[model samples]
Target chain A: TQLLEQSPQFLSIQEGENLTVYCNSSSVFSSLQWYRQEPGEGPVLLVTVVTGGEVKKLKRLTFQFGDARKDSSLHITAAQTGDTGLYLCAGERAGGFKTIFGAGTRLFVKA
Target chain B: SAVISQKPSRDICQRGTSLTIQCQVDSQVTMMFWYRQQPGQSLTLIATANQGSEATYESGFVIDKFPISRPNLTFSTLTVSNMSPEDSSIYLCSVHGGQGNTGELFFGEGSRLTVL
Candidate 1:
């Protein structure tokens, strides 16, 4: 049983504040993906990090995969009100048949 | 990227009744998955619907309670039988496109069920 644990289950920050969320797991994964889900909508893929020590950026959002492939992080710089959403981290097994998701961090950025 | 659509976007049903949700994809996909998301919780994989075989359910999930049907490459259905209030949640249909399992999954606007 593989599980990914996420931190800061809830967060509320003023506009222009920066924040970082983390996802850690005891098991190794072949690839990790980040997703953002707003209210009343399914999660949308933000980025995918396939290699250990890999980093991918989408606009002001940055994602990093740990060197051991057991952890990952998402950093938002100068966060805006639009960045408010539930951020989820998912890890895919080597065969890509099984994927496990983290609990997710719900961020609320006030304007 | 594939576009996915789910029918009965939101439904309020009485307890002990059944609800069948339909998922349609614009293009053929290699894999289709069903997930349940409890309020303020993460997505839990319920089962993997194979194109021609019986759906493979994850641990804690059984085929009898949540039966799945995948008749072709682009369509699937999930029926929640004998529902209860605890069963009220968002059900999402996801698909993996591209060749040979190289692509990420695309999700449909989930079907939200509220059992009263």
Candidate 2:
């Protein structure tokens, strides 16, 4: 089975603090995606990183893909209360449409 | 953007009972996905709902416990049978990819169920 492991399962920081989450795997992926989910709601897509070494920025969040397509990371700059959520990373296999997800990183940004 | 909605946004059910959740997508989508999230956990894929075809379930899941249906491209339903306390979770429906069909996926608000 292909597994994606997320580090630092829990994080809490005051407003304006910075944090980074990592997702690593032993298998290569055709594409990788990041999502943030709030309480009582489904996950919302943050970014999709397909190519190795690719990076995408959305407001205060920056997502990066590993050079080997086996890992990804999400960095939050000047975190806020609105950034408090569970961050997830999912990867799609090359020859199939099936996807695998990491355990997750729960971030709490207190104001 | 393809907007997806799941019925019974939240429900409290008794043990041994069953509940069927409905998912509706505003636009025609090629792939409709079902996921389950336990408290403080990441989403786990239950199955892939295909139009006019039988749903393909993943390992650790059984067809008898979770029966799925997709009669058309824009609609699908998932039924959980013989509910137990452990069955309580948030069920979400997601559409794979958007316009031009990148690897991105769009999700519904989700159905939250608590089995008492």
Candidate 3:
């Protein structure tokens, strides 16, 4: 079974602070995706990284895929109150449609 | 991107009862997925529903406890049978975005069930 382990299960930070969350796995994936879910809503896709060592940026967020495709990271610069939500990392196998998700990182950014 | 809608956005059910959640998508999709999520947690895929075929459940999930029906390309239903307190969770319906296997999913608002 493939599992993605996420670090810092919970985070509380003041506005304008920078934070980073990590997701690691032993199994290699064909692609990795990051999602943000707010209260009472399903997760929304933030970005998808398909290549090893690939990095993608969305406004104040930066996502990185590991060189071995076994891990990923999400970094938020100057996080605002709007950034508070649950962040999840999902991995897709090379030849399958199945997607495995991490435990998720709950971030709370206070204004 | 496809717009998805779920019925019974929130419900309170008694233990031992059953609830069937419905999912409707604006566009026809080849595959539909069902997921369960505990509060403040990540999603766990329950099964994959395909039109004109039986649903494929994950390792820990069984068809008896969660029966799924995909009568067509744009609709599906998931029934949680003999529910218990542990069955209280948010159920989400989702479909792949665009064409091919892009690894991107668009999800519905989700049906939140609370079992007493």
Scored by CA lDDT, what does every candidate get?
0.90, 0.90, 0.93
Residue-wise C-alpha lDDT for candidate 2, range B38-91, written one tens digit per residue:
888888999999887788999889889999989899999999899999999999
Give the higher-TM-score candidate: 1 or 3: 3
Residue-by-residue lDDT tens digits, candidate 1, A1-110: 43898988899999999999999998888888888999888888888888899999899999999999999999999999999999999978666667789999999999
Window of ten residues with lowest summed lDDT in model 2 chain A: A91-100
Off by over 4 Å in 1: B97-103
| Superposed Cα RMSD, model 2 | 1.3
lDDT per residue, candidate 2, A1-111, as tens digits? 339999888999999999999999988889999988999888888889988999999998899999999999999999999998899899886776877888999999999
Cα displacement (angstroms), candidate 1, residue B35, comes to 0.2
lDDT of 1 by residue, B1-116 (tens): 78999998999999999999999999987579999999999999999998989999998999899999999999999999999999999999998745543436779999999999
Candidates 2 and 3: which is better by TM-score?
Answer: 3
Q: Pick the lDDT winner.
A: 3
Measured against the native two-chain assembly using Cα atoms, what DockQ does each of the candidate structures obtain, in the order listed? 0.68, 0.76, 0.83
Candidate 3 lDDT tens digits, A46-65? 99999999999999999999
| lDDT score at residue B31, model 1, on the 0-100 scale | 73
Candidate 1 vs candidate 2: the DockQ winner is: 2
DockQ winner between candidates 2 and 3: 3
Residues B1-116, model 3: lDDT tens digits: 89999998999999999999999999999899999998777899999999999999998999999999999999999999999999999999999878654888889999999999
Misplaced by over 4 Å in model 3 are none
